[model samples]
Target chain A: MELFALSDVPEVREGDDLAAIVEDRVDLRADDVLCVASTVVSKADGRTVNLDDVTAGDRARAIAERLEAITGEAKDPRFAQVVLEESNDLVMEAPFILSETRFGHITVNAGIDRSNVPEADLLLLPEDPTGSAERLHEELGVPVVVTDTCGRPFRHGQRGVAIGWAGMPASRDWRGETDRDGRELGVTVESVVDELAAASNLLAGEGDGGTPFVVVREFDFGDHGGSDNLFREYDDDLIRQALQAWEFPG
Target chain B: MELFALSDVPEVREGDDLAAIVEDRVDLRADDVLCVASTVVSKADGRTVNLDDVTAGDRARAIAERLEAITGEAKDPRFAQVVLEESNDLVMEAPFILSETRFGHITVNAGIDRSNVPEADLLLLPEDPTGSAERLHEELGVPVVVTDTCGRPFRHGQRGVAIGWAGMPASRDWRGETDRDGRELGVTVESVVDELAAASNLLAGEGDGGTPFVVVREFDFGDHGGSDNLFREYDDDLIRQALQAWEFPG
Candidate 1:
């Protein structure tokens, strides 16, 4: 499979048609799978926020003060408030906020962006990333994977992950499958959408020279069982469960 | 960037020259990045083990008994012994085995495989994946990323990750970079090797049809600064610290 970024994508604005923008920039193939940065999706969906307009709640202010005391850096309560407003739950409330968004993705700061916004002070991840992807997929008639960059546990730095996807299953299920020796496979679920997002994110780095829209061509999902159960529920996630009873020493 | 899996990789044997195997299969290009799955690398390095050869000690047996009690599944003390022998630290001990391997990768069971071995009963990850990649990089005159599929804290399914990389930096440091509006970029370090491995993993799924090696062509690392730090140290990882202070409620 081949991947290329869409060049010269103008600064996105609220109410802009992402599908039309992509369709105008390139003649997309039927087999193409488009990976979109959530920045543009948020832009089109009016997900940007101005801190001046945000009111910091008691919780946000307390969290910000605690963060400031712990990290020795200036903390913005309005930003914390925005994260709180966008989140369903705060998985980690101190040192840094690890949260679950309304759309069920667990990420830092509710996947909020302090940068990458031209028209607003902050750009929130799409209100519903999977819904955003579905809209694009419906308009473009191809698979759409909405991508984001986030830090993960047990590893340094960050890479791309799929917050939402459409027109394709989120993962390829390898259960009951066998390896070359016909032994049962160890890896049961392969998150193909996340892999696609990571691949596109490699081509679309963050910066002035960044490319937000990437086209992945000729990828075959194969004749394997597919699954859309990409996000784990509260009872199923061990880390989330562990975090519930544990507190940061700070 | 284009990615394609190398076909017809025969069952890897111990003492195999991996570079020679790739060279014989395809005429590789200098610009291509080769992603070799850990299974093949382990096999080539004689990292397989026989269950009969292992002796479960007191610790392994006790741990296995606890796990079986908690999960209500038949647990093997010998398997737990293998995992203990392979691990430097156990981040999670109950309900499951989460460990830090000798080479610093934090994964379940120190990434030992009970499947994917043709001759042995178990397959262990390479002793030093970076060293394995370095040797291949030296022989082939191109980048090599040793890939592994792993589960993370929040996400549901597993995706590809880089356990070891050579001939290129692990991450593209975007420090001091600016967005389109000339604002300092929010994302600083982009883990390019992990992204590359994730891309290759999309094409090389686990099964009888699995392709252990994939070639990624024309992936540009750009003009950004590079860093070789992929795994997190203890002080730098917050989740590790959290895991330290908590125990499984089970």
Candidate 2:
């Protein structure tokens, strides 16, 4: 597979026509998979929330205070409150606040990003990433994957994940398929969308790396569709059991 | 960045000179990062273990019974016993067995694989991935990252992770570094090695695809060293706290 980031893309703002900008900047091909940073999509969708306009609720204030005392992460309670407004549930509150977002994403701070945006505002994930991807796919006439970076449970650093995707299956399921040794494969589904997101980061640097739009070519997915299957419902996941099992001993 | 898997690699076996085989198959350059599947490394190092030789210990048998009852994963008690032998600690026993390997990797089944192997044998991760990476780096004269697929806590499917790496920093520490907008990046260290691992998966299919070695070119790390920092200490991690909080309800 070949990956290249858009070389000349200007700072994105609200209501920007991203499809036009990307088409103008990069040469598109039929089989290319376009990967866009979720921040840019949020900006185009006018999803920015200003902290100054947010007032921390009692819960947000208490959580923010505890977070600040423990990890020194939240300097302003409004930020924590904004995170709360964007979240479906507060998964954790001590070391860091892990929020389960309405999009069924379990991430830190409800995927509210403060970096690479206006200082006073936080950029929440697109209201509907799959919809955004579908719209972009229609406009661009190719596959599109909306991506974001999040910390993982075991690994120390973050890698990109596909928050929204269209025109390709997020995973390649080889459940009943046999391997070269004729052994039946067990639970060996490949998460293709997340891998594409991580590959895009080779050019989409974490900071000041202007290349947010990546075009991946020559990846033969053969026949594929949407990323809906990549998400495990909260009730079906073991993390729920782990959370219910949580008992902070004195 | 450009990626391509070697199309000419023969079926690897124990005691094969993998570096020589890879060098013979593909040309390596200075700036390239070679990501080899840990299975191949294990195969080269003769790390495969047979079920017939392993007798399930009491803990393994009990854990195997619990896992089999919960997820129907462990077909035999020996599989569970092999996983236990490969792990530093048994982090969990319900739904799945999360093993903390000696190499600081928290993965399911202790990174053991029964697929694509000789029947009745299980493939384990390399004994020392960092040392293996270091040796490969010296032999190939290029950056080497040993990769394995592991399930993430939040995501439904697994992604490739760097178990051992050399030649560049596993994480690009941009802490205190200014963004394009002159904002200081906070905890924005990019995990380059892990990204490469994920990128390599574009060519390295999960099941019986035969393409185990991937060469990633044109990626720049500026200046770097090893993958030591990619591992978070058990004491300094929140997952530990989460695991400690795990008190299974009756």
Best by TM-score: 1
Model 1 C-alpha lDDT per residue in residues B1-250, reported as the tens digit of each score: 9999998888889999889989998888878999999999999989989999999999999999999999999999999999999988889898899989999999998998877788989999999999999999999999999999988888788999999999999999999888888898888999999999999998888777658999999999989999999998888887887886678877
Error of 1 at A68 (Å): 0.8
The stretch of ten residues in a row with the least summed lDDT in candidate 1 chain A is A241-250
For A1-250, candidate 1 gives per-residue lDDT tens digits of: 9999999898889999999999998998888999999999999999889989999999999999999999999999999999999999889998889989998899989989877788889999998899999999999999999999988888878899999999999999999888888889889999999999999999989877658999999999988899999989888898887876677888
Model 1, B35: alpha-carbon shift in Å?
0.5
What TM value does model 1 have?
A: 0.99
Per residue, candidate 2 scores C-alpha lDDT tens digits across A136-245 of: 99999998999998887766767788899998788876666777788886546778889899889768877777888999988877432323577777777767457535
Per-candidate alpha-carbon RMSD to the true structure: 0.9, 2.1
Stretches of model 1 off by over 4 angstroms after superposition = none
lDDT of each: 0.91, 0.80
Q: Across residues B101-220, which tens digit of lDDT does each residue of candidate 2 receive?
A: 888888888988877776347888898999999999999999899998878776677778889998777887767666558776543767888989999977887776799999998888
